[model samples]
Target: MAASSQGPVNGVGEDKTSVRRQSEANRKLKYISLAVLVVQNASLILSIRYVRTLPGERFFTTSAVVMAEVLKVLTCLLIILLQKRGSLRAFIKLLYDSIFVQYLDTLKLAVPSLIYTLQNNLQYVAISNLPAATFQVTYQLKILTTALFSVLMLRKSLSRVQWVSLVLLFAGVAIVQVEQEGKQKETTVSSGSQNYAKGLVAVVVSCLSSGFAGVYFEKILKGSSASVWMRNVQLGIFGTFLGLLGLWWNDGPAIAEKGFLFGYTPMVWGVIFNQAFGGLLVAVVVKYADNILKGFATSFSIVVSTVTSVYLFGFHVDLLFTLGAGLVIGAVYMYSLPKAASPSSSSSSSSSSSTVSSSSSAHSRSHLSNSDADSETDAFLPKSVLVK
Candidate 1:
């Protein structure tokens, strides 16, 4: 009996060890992911700002988005080419059906379309009002906002560590914002605090809208007709039309520039590059990796975002503010960890269900066997003899 018990205990010990190892591996992966995200955001800031300062730069907010969408469609087309090891027409047609196809009637697209426009416009407004450094701060706040919304709006529960991290992250952002504001005051006295506040509001709106978009896109992916690109293509087309209308409304066509075929500038190319590859590189990493890794990749993003904005652009960085930024980033890591829900609980649930099912099956089998035996006995007794 002791030998038998020892065998079971050893088996359980091995199982526990296996689980712990897998969890540890996932944790490390998440950390690596956080660093990668930081690099992506930093590079994006540096690229966009640099392009804007270039000679004959035509990368207005609208142009940038349009170019980006164009590149996405192009990328999709390229993907189709690569995957088309067989019948090209059939494959292309299938892709077109998936992407160019629309499931929702015009009305369904109308509402989200309107909302997307408002969100996009708000982002441009923020970009215009604030510098790269300030914008990065606001965007980085998404991790906190996402967590907050997850708890409050989505009614999701987070661990204590996650909650603490959220608080630390927020504190850090607040500190960074304050420091950045002070620097802004010293450098350019053109606009007052009110403008910064306005920009901040816009940035916040942008973040919230993006978060909402993610939800909607997920919802649609659970179902949509147009491939992600085709869907994006429609969005780009619609957004451009509205943008043109807004431009036309604000100034009338007297100031309208002719020849809008992407303007063919290097900045235009950069926008394409950024959207298609640069930005998506991080997304691809995030998608394949687990949540833990995503947090890890984006862990230093806020700091990188701040540094890239300040240093590369010759902006300011307050030590206290940077410290705060680090705190916020630490919060992101805390938030990203896997929950410690026990495997035993799941195992117990499975066992209970199995017991019930096994009992039911056993009873059915028993009844069937009894009936079979009775039939066999009756057959053994000859029909006429059994009647007596």
Candidate 2:
């Protein structure tokens, strides 16, 4: 009789142990995902900076953008293949069905995708002409532009703190840009000012493209039920088409003179691969993590990039640049603060607990689907980096 009574307690103990183990495993997976995202972002910036140092490369922007898009498509296909249980035929069928069912929705993102292609090319230009640290700091202007676009396109209201953060973001970028200008004036290198001016133009255009593409993509994602991989595939296809057009427009004469892929090197390939894979990692992070974490990742990446730039390229960081970067990082942290729930909303949620429970159940199921997809993708990563 005592043994029978102890049996139920033993089963309960085992169940608790299992739950504790599962929770620990999940925590590890989240940390692994965050680490991968941080590494990817840092590598992306470093690789671009490395590419700019390669000698005798001409018209690398067009070729790198094209190759990156092609790689993105391939990565998307790989994700689809894994998600479809490794059945290429099934994957193709799903692709066909999705095209038919969501073609219009995909088409809606075409313009933004093209804009992204432009932004990609401009990024190369800016990195080539500007110091990597300066470029990274100045690039924070995209956050401001993204906020503006979110307000205008998504009709989202920003809190006063967010608006102040935007203002701080602008001030930080201006400080960095001014520091660059002052350094340019101090240097006697011929065409230094001209190159700096050109880089500024590229950065501004890239910021606008990033802002618009981000808002447009968010709109599409909200309005559609397609998975993140499917949307990325659609964007990749459009980006590749637009990249080809851009190549023809900008590099036609150069291509005719030197032929395609004339300036290819291992470093260029590194840049292309980093660009493509970094994008996929970012999408994964966004799917699995909250915006606050994503913002933290970005801010962390800037710090890593800046430090690596100094050691790898012998880049110098001055007081003004340090101050500006501090301001930018502070602004990012400020923007990432979670909004407080209103009392009315809290009371309503408490009153409608049953309805909320049902909705939460559906949300949990949806979240599980996303997590499964992420897990499948993680299989392609290193064994040490498994999501779960």
Candidate 3:
């Protein structure tokens, strides 16, 4: 009896140790991912703005989109291969099974992939036409759209606070637009051909597409056992094909004259890699951190972009822009806050509260188990609200 008691005590102690270690590891990862996300979000936009604004031969945006897709595909493939412990046979078989054997499922990604590709192209258009700071502030529209779609498609419940946040977000963007229009009129001659109207339209459309594609991708992920990287590979495949088609349609003549990489420069290459890396970084951030932290990173990124724009592009932020940006940032943080436990759920478990508590404790200990890793796909999607 003494020996058995000691054995049980030892097991309990070990479990506690394991849980503690896992928690610490996750905490570190959460912060690291958050940091990287802030940098990536800011840098990608700034770099794109820099490249597009340069006065030399402009690189073909369509070709850049296609190249981004190709690089994304290759990067995802390499990650999957590494996951298979460098086993080439295993990697090939897994790809064949996921991409070929499961052809129907693979085809489902085509819709979102196409939308994503278009959204990517539109981003270039928007950035070229608008100031980096304004674009960043306006791009938060994706969060509002994502929440709306989540309610409609996923039937996800949003707290009252979240609803209010959405309203504030829209109002903020509208204010920014109003101010931007005024500013554009003043600087029209000085600002060259930058078109506020064109950029506004492109960004709005991009936000819509982003919202739909992200939710659609999340729906596919929830019902499947495939890893996020695998789905990315699937999306990448379709994206590459769609991107090439877009390239042919939009920039075929230009490419024929100047070659595929016509105005390619080192900075252009950097932007491509930055875009690709940012896409993959989203997966890691989603895996380690929740949407709330991601929102904080986004909020920080906006601030970074705004500050950088001031120095680099001589962006002038006035009272309206500041007020509007502040509201948007606040909305982002509020929207990301976790919904409080519903009274119904609380009441339902009231009778067995003690039992529930014990079970929760047990779950806490086992939450970092392999099963949790397998279910990572549920959080892997590029969700602006839940997964982003």
lDDT of 3 by residue, 111-216 (tens): 9889988898899999999899899999999988888888899899988889999999999898998888888776677877688889899999998988888788
Give lDDT tens digits, candidate 1, residues 23-93: 68856865655555556656655555455544553434554454454565466556555666667897778
Would you list the rank order by TM-score, best first? 3, 2, 1
Q: What are the lDDT figures for the candidates, one per model?
A: 0.54, 0.71, 0.80
Report how far off residue 271 is in candidate 2 (Å). Answer: 0.8
> Higher lDDT: candidate 1 or 2?
2
In model 3, pairs of residues that clash are: 383-388
Candidate 1 residue spans exceeding 4 A from truth: 1-36, 53-58, 84-86, 99-102, 105-121, 148-155, 190-195, 223-255, 261-268, 339-388
RMSD of each: 17.0, 6.0, 4.3
Q: Rank the models by lDDT, top first.
A: 3, 2, 1
Clashes of each: 11, 0, 1
Which predicted model would earn the best lDDT? 3
